[model samples]
Target: MKIAVIGSKGLPPRQGGIEHYCAEVYPRMVAQGHQVDLFARSSWIHLPWYQSCRFHGVQVISLPCPGKRGLDGLISSSLGAIACLGKRYDIIHFHALGPSLFCWLPRMAASAKVVVSCHGLDWQREKWGNCSSCLIWLGEQVAIRCSDQIIVVSEALVDYFQDTYAVEAINIPNGPASYWQSDPTFSFVKLLGLEPQKYLLFLGRLVPEKCPDLLIQAFQRLTSTGWKLAIVGGQSDAPAYQMNLFKLAAANPNIIFAGELKERYLAEIVRGAGLFILPSNLEGLPLAMLEAMQEGIPVVASDIPPHRQLIGMNRGRLFHAGDLESCIQMIDWAIQHSKEMKKMAQKAQEHVQTWYGWDGITAATLRTYESLLCPPRSKVKPATELIQR
Candidate 1:
């Protein structure tokens, strides 16, 4: 099938869950003999507008972008939507709510089945201002109205759509990216003064929603000794928040801000970690946590729905969301009770490996596309019936 993808930074996934998600799923789709053309931002690809390249068999076309935080996605997605209008794509898949704003264009102008994957509720993110948040919200509404099928990354999102918009969305969770086993000598992390099982790791974008500041605050108040905090991520349009985090950790020499480690470096840090903590107030089935669990690293996350879904049932520990005391308690417990945390890590590793493989995720996505295009003739409810006015 010919597919057109929109709403990702670019291929090879420098940062962001949507980008990594595209890098994993679409390439696999290409390997399965599907033609996938991904529309990307020139800001990310650093290429001339309209220039195209191939990554692991998937064709990535760069579109003009201003490189601004919110405007970049808006302009790129608009152009991407217009570009799809001239093509004969079987499926035009949009990755996030911001880009799904233009999903209506392909639905109305092209002969394609539009699919919108709601990775998260972007409107609730603190980085986006009121105008940007409103635009994102409108995109969500537009996606509900225009798309042939909607895909959500977590059951929490499924419940969100049903309760808020009365819309039925398919739940398809994200899979972990392949991790390389780093050198046992621990050369890379040792450069940052991080020792194996002697530091806690927080891996994700340094954003307000992810609450790196909260982690820093909690880490400062911890009663533990000899253990350091290694915060690894890029500041995505949240430089001020990132700066604030740095300030919060300024007095504490134990906190190390190792900006954005990828591939082997990332693998080493994660593998060497004593614990992986994500105190996010919001999430769409965090891929970072998934990767940590897949590596058999114990986790301590906020009591958000997505985190609970991943870590509940003794898979990992959870603390009250946004509570400093709760976070401190969980971290201290996980550190002190090493044997119990190791057992939970084993269970989490097994759970993710068994349930969240990329091949299975790709296959499930393809099945969703096929069902939309060649739906069975058995007595089934129409797509319109799935949405309540």
Candidate 2:
């Protein structure tokens, strides 16, 4: 099958979840004998417009885009959709609500089956202005009306679509990134002034919705426990919010802002953590938390629906979302109860390893694509019925 992918920033997955997801899923599809052309942003790739590159057997084609926040996504998606009109693709897949705005272009101009993957409700995010939010909302409506299939990352999102739009979306959760073993010598962590199992880690984009500020404030209120706080991630067009978080941690020398550690450095930091924390108000199955859990690290997260789905049933600890006091209490409890936290970490690691493997996710996604292409003979009969015969 020939597939055209739209809505990711670019290949090597420097930051965003969508890019990482594409990096994992699409290349496996290529290995399975499907050709995938991923349309990316020139701004992200740092390449000239319309330049093409290969990433793990997938063709990544960079398209022109403005450097502005909202405009970049809109312009790149529009151009990607326009490019799809010239190709004879079997599937035209889009990644987020913002890019799904152009899902109609392929359906109108070509004979491709359209698939839209909603990572999250971007309109609900705190960073976007009202105009951008409204545009994202409109894109959601367009995706519902135009796309042949809709894929959501969490059960909460599946319920949201069912209740709000009376539509059923395929529920496919994200798989964890490759698990890494840090150097036993702890060479890199020592340079950062961190010791193994002596620091709390917050790993995600420094955005308002993720609420790194809440973590900083909560950490500040705790009495001296010899546990340093390491905030590890990049800014996502939210420099002001990131700056405010720095200010929140300004008085404390123990608070470390280790900006964007990739590969082995990231692995070492995550593995050395005493506790992993995410105080997010919104999420669509957080990949950071998933990776932490896969590393067998104990997690403390806000009690959002997606978090509950992942960490509920005694898998990990949860605090009330956006409540500073609740966050403080949860962190205190997790720290004090070391043995219990370790037990929960073991359970969480087992759960992720059993259910969230990337190979399974890729195969499930392929089945969805194949089902669309080779649908049952009769609309009233189930596909299973044909298989039974």
* Among all candidates shown, the one with the greatest lDDT: 1
lDDT by residue (87-134, candidate 1, tens digit) is 899999999999999999998899999999999998999888899999
Which pairs clash in model 2? none
Clashes of each: 0, 0
What shift in Å separates residue 205 of candidate 1 from its native position after superposition?
Answer: 1.6
Q: Where in model 1 is the C-alpha error above 4 Å?
A: 377-389
**Reference-based lDDT, residue 62, model 1:** 98
The list of candidate 2 runs beyond 4 A from truth reads 179-181, 377-389
Q: What TM-scores do the predictions have?
A: 0.94, 0.94
Error of 2 at 95 (Å): 0.4
User: Model 2 Cα displacement at 34 (Å)?
Assistant: 0.8
lDDT against the true structure, per candidate, is 0.90, 0.89
Angstrom error at residue 282, model 1: 0.8
Task: Provide the lDDT at 246 for model 2.
Answer: 77
